[model samples]
Target: MTGFDSHLFEGRTVVVTGAGRGIGAAVAAAFLHCGASVIAHAGRDLSHAEGDLLSRVPSAARSRLVLLTEDLAAPDGGAQLADQVLARTGVIDVLVNNAGTMGGRIRAGEETAETYDHVLDLNIRSVVALTGCLLPALRASEQASIVNTVSISARAGGSAGSALYAGTKAFVSGWTKTLAKELAPDGIRVNAVSPGTIMTDFHRRYSTPEKLEATAAAIPLKRLGMADDCAPAYVFLAAGSLSGYVTGQVLEVNGGQLMP
Candidate 1:
């Protein structure tokens, strides 16, 4: 919990999706701590924020926080969120596409068309739609940075029951690179943060304690990661002062789990 410069993001506007809890909440709070006005999409509800996210922000900074709730898996979810953002601000300094989920385990061969739609809708379609909808605002900034949330599972192929989720992340990893190149001319940098085995509710619902312990034992650092551990990377990637020249890269925050 080291402190960042209070004025690092002064006068900036940042939008973070999936900010109700876990990694998204930490990233949103980090921007608020650094003096940015933030628009946080709190998933489908505010239940997770009551205890987890709201407590993390200082009262003084609360004035700069705007919370929105939308189900990104719905047909027009991304567009709806973007409309809200546009109504609030004309320009965006940072966009963190962190709203995504595995939607539970659908084992191989047992995957239904319904499951496929849900996974893709939440993970891939929503991201594309949101980013596309916000491109003009992003371009309006003198310099804008997009930090997407990918997963180590994208590369490792993941363990049982998560192949579809892994594929979506892989798609995002590739899209991040492609968007970096496509948007470079507009002075917008696109990159991604690929977290490895974070100990969030994501794992609580999708993984067993035995499996998590085994993962920790196998990692070179002998532990899984925490949401705080991944937050600074987003801040670094989002701040032009910090990572102005960095783009199209997947920064790994895995506690040495994957060297690549």
Candidate 2:
């Protein structure tokens, strides 16, 4: 079977959370294209994710892609997903923790405890729990990679109403570095990708047309990014053949929006 890079990860297995939409979908497709057996974990509902995925891939690669439906927001969801994966396959070579929500731009003064709890549990807690549950599976692989999807908001502190979302991403960035150190000895590299103003539903819900123009003007690239632009960063980090020496770092995919 031929993959994008001609079987770059012919025998690898990857789990991509939030694979039903946007960046997550793109990343999962990229892995499948490159010959990785992918467990595409879609949250809450499957919707048409499986059909959407098949539309973007070749028939040969279709068998390698497994659609896993689960609610990662549930308390036991992460463990359940991990168990399901291990039951199907003995090893997981890459873990892409990409499921997240912008939480719809509530002002700091207007944010409720309920809102805060939901954001933390889905964005932070679920990521940690899932990784913990899958450590053994990852350890079994010869090359293990964890790619956490951070955001340009993490470094820039977000726009007016997204402080909480930005804060959670900052925690992700810090945790990436620390976790990298802890896993380095195990040969399990941890890294993050910080995407800038990608034109996804994230901005469709929170950003106005005027706001988008201002953001585009501020960037040296003079335009907003597509979901595809950010997908390669995840693939790069996951392919140890490409980034084996790289770890504990954040790769910014912001089109020069923020130099850091």
Candidate 3:
């Protein structure tokens, strides 16, 4: 449904985590629209997909979408998802490590070991595990691209109670750069998409209406972002023809909220 070429990703295979709803679903749908066979990890359940993700794809493209449900926070969760992917295909043209969460806003002093582990496990550990497991498949492709989901909070030190989540994102940002350099030898490029305050369910749960309004006012664009606004960045980064020379970069889709 985007303005991108329908055949942009023809004959390619893409894997997207957290695709049941919000930004992840939008990203998955975008790739499908562009003609890629998509393996979408729909979080821990398919309930969200029935309404959110499934509604986005037309009936014609439904055949190209494969939905899987997994709890990426569980033990060896990433590897388990990778197993499902490998069973389906040996070559992955694009890997979008977009499954992550804030886990909720735990105040600095109020945090516990359990909370720390939960956030780290979901945001950092799972991504590393998934990407590691998929390396062989990625290397099989003539050109492979890895796109990670980072956040404005990574650099801006997000609002109070989000320190742990922000730290995890920052870690991924650094990892994305490191992997880009390390994987370049194999013709695989690694990059990340840092989204601004998008008006998705993520904000609905963590950000109050008043806070969202204030934040929107502060942005130069005078509004918050959307899942669709962030989807194009993933498509652009995944399409080698579009960003063949780009790597180790964090493309910001924050609507001028952070100029840097």
Clashing pairs in 1: none
Task: Report every candidate's CA lDDT.
Answer: 0.93, 0.87, 0.95
TM-score of each prediction: 0.98, 0.95, 0.99
Please identify which of the two predictions, 1 or 3, would achieve the higher TM-score against the true structure: 3
Better of 2 and 3 by TM-score: 3
* Tens-digit lDDT string for candidate 1 (57-87): 9999999999999889997899999998899
How do the residues 134-182 of candidate 3 rate in per-residue lDDT, one tens digit apiece? 9999999998999999999999989989999999999999999999999
Question: Sorted on lDDT, highest at the top, how do the candidates line up?
Answer: 3, 1, 2
How many angstroms is residue 197 displaced in model 2 relative to the true structure, after the best TM-score fit?
0.6
Query: Which residues of candidate 1, in runs, are more than 4 Å off?
Result: none
Model 3 spans with C-alpha error above 4 angstroms: none
Candidate 3: residue 66 lDDT (0-100): 99
